[model samples]
Target: MHIRPEQAGDSHPIAELTRRAFARAKHSDGTEQDIIDRLRKRGKLTCSLVACLGTEIIGHIAFSPVCIIGAHNQHPQWYGLGPVSVIPAQQRRGIGKTLITQGLATLEKTGTAGGCVVLGDPGYYQQFGFMPSPNLTYPHAPAQYFMVRSFDSNIPAGIVRYDAAFDT
Candidate 1:
């Protein structure tokens, strides 16, 4: 699959792909599509991307700014990675992984100081250097499932808050 930044024209197919991908997921809120829509409408899709075979989009991933509480009132340049989805028929073909690898690599290039966080399975995310961070927390998230991959030695310690777009 070829991975590329999501263009505006890809929104509808991506929404459909996301809806279908998570339709039967264990922890799906059944609103993954809405979340993506909200995020995009708010201009919070920091690095949205798509995994495709030729012109057909098969996978999608998104990143958005996150706030680190108690960062001493300084600007927190953290990002949250989530709602990654690959079409059910395309699952396990490494499409999701490819999208993640590409997205995170792109995040690294933004000179992000607070790095990235994801609420996902440890088994899968660990390979990408994401580890459970005791110092950083996402409210109500299982400690082990909420992970971070800091870009620096001094990892920020605080509550991680996703954008208001996630409020719904």
Candidate 2:
């Protein structure tokens, strides 16, 4: 399997993969594709990566800017990682992991020390250093579903907000 930056042509395949991956979930809201569309329109999709086996896109991941505001009115650096999807047929093959690791490494190389936030299973994300943020909260989601991983130790704590597109 090869991991590479997603190109323009990968959109359709990626969408299909996302749909298939989330179709059977109890919480399928059809919002994953919407989020990707909005992020693309806003040009805030920092790093979109895909894991491929030959010409097929088996997995995908995206990172976009997020902000954390502290009680003292301090706004620290951060980004949100989300909507990670692996084609249902390929779920256990580590494609999601490859996409995430590659995407994060690319973000770090670009001087993004703001860290990353994700709404996901702690058991899975913990493997990548993500943990619940004691200093932050997401009103709409359970606290346990929200997590943060600091890429730099100096980032301040604050309310985490994703781009407006996420609200759609």
Candidate 3:
């Protein structure tokens, strides 16, 4: 299996994969694909990657811009991760982890010091250096679900807001 950046033609299959993966999961809202579509249309899909086994797309992950609003100010440089999906049949094979590792490496290489954030299991994401930021918060979501990881350690704390596309 190999992983690579998603291409234009991969949209349909990736969407289907996302839908199927989340359909019966614990948080199935049936909106992940819509969020992805909106993010792509808005040009906020800063990092979108897919795991391929030959000609099949078995997993996908994306990262888009997020902001933090602190007591003193708001930061708009940070990015957020989300809506990561792996084909149901491909789950438990580490495809999601691989996609995240590669995507984060690419972001760091591009000098994205603002770092990445996500709403996920703390234990799972902590392996990637993601932690709850005392200075940051996502008021709309559960406290534990909002987490961040700074690539440069210079990003300030504040309310983390994902791109508008995520509202879909």
Candidate 4:
């Protein structure tokens, strides 16, 4: 399978894939797709990637800017990664991994991103260099589930506020 940036026509399929992918997830509230749509509408999707086998899009990942409100009052180019999805039939084939790998690589290449934060399983995200930092926390969730993968040594400490689209 190949991974590439998402195109305009891939939106609907991505939505369907996201819905089916997270339909039964223990932590999903069933609005993952809607979050994507809102992010797109608000022009906050910093990076969106899709994994495809031939002409079919099988997996997807999204990244958006996140605000880090710290005591230092520094707002770096940090981003949030989430809603990664692979169709149930294609799950566990490493499509999700490929999508994340490619997406993060793209962000790093741009040299504009400070790092990325993800709210997910520590075991799964740890492989991607994501670790819980006492300095950075998301108040809405447990500290263990919120992980950060800094591109450099400077990992900020503070409350991470995802885009307003995620508030719902």
Q: Which run of 10 residues does model 2 get worst, by summed lDDT?
A: 68-77
Clashes of each: 0, 2, 1, 1
What residue runs in model 4 are displaced by over 4 Å at the alpha carbon?
71-75
lDDT per residue for candidate 1 within 46-158, as digits (tens), equals 99999989889999999998989866655448899988999999999888888999899998887754689999899999998999878888876889999998876557888
* Model 4 worst lDDT window (10 residues): 67-76
Candidate 4 clashes between residue pairs 3 or more apart in a chain or in different chains: 135-157
What is the C-alpha lDDT profile of model 2 across 76-127, one tens digit per residue? 4578897899988888777788787877778777774567888888888888
Task: Output the number of the lDDT-best candidate.
Answer: 4
lDDT of 4 by residue, 10-129 (tens): 999999999999997888999999999999999999899999899998999999999888648554599999889999999998888888888889988888788999999998999999
Name every residue pair that clashes in candidate 3: 69-159
Q: Which candidate is the best by TM-score?
A: 4
State the RMSD for candidate 2. 1.7
Off-target runs (Cα >4 Å) in candidate 3 are: 71-76
The residue pairs that clash in candidate 2, if any, are 69-158, 69-159
Candidates in order have lDDT scores of 0.88, 0.80, 0.84, 0.90
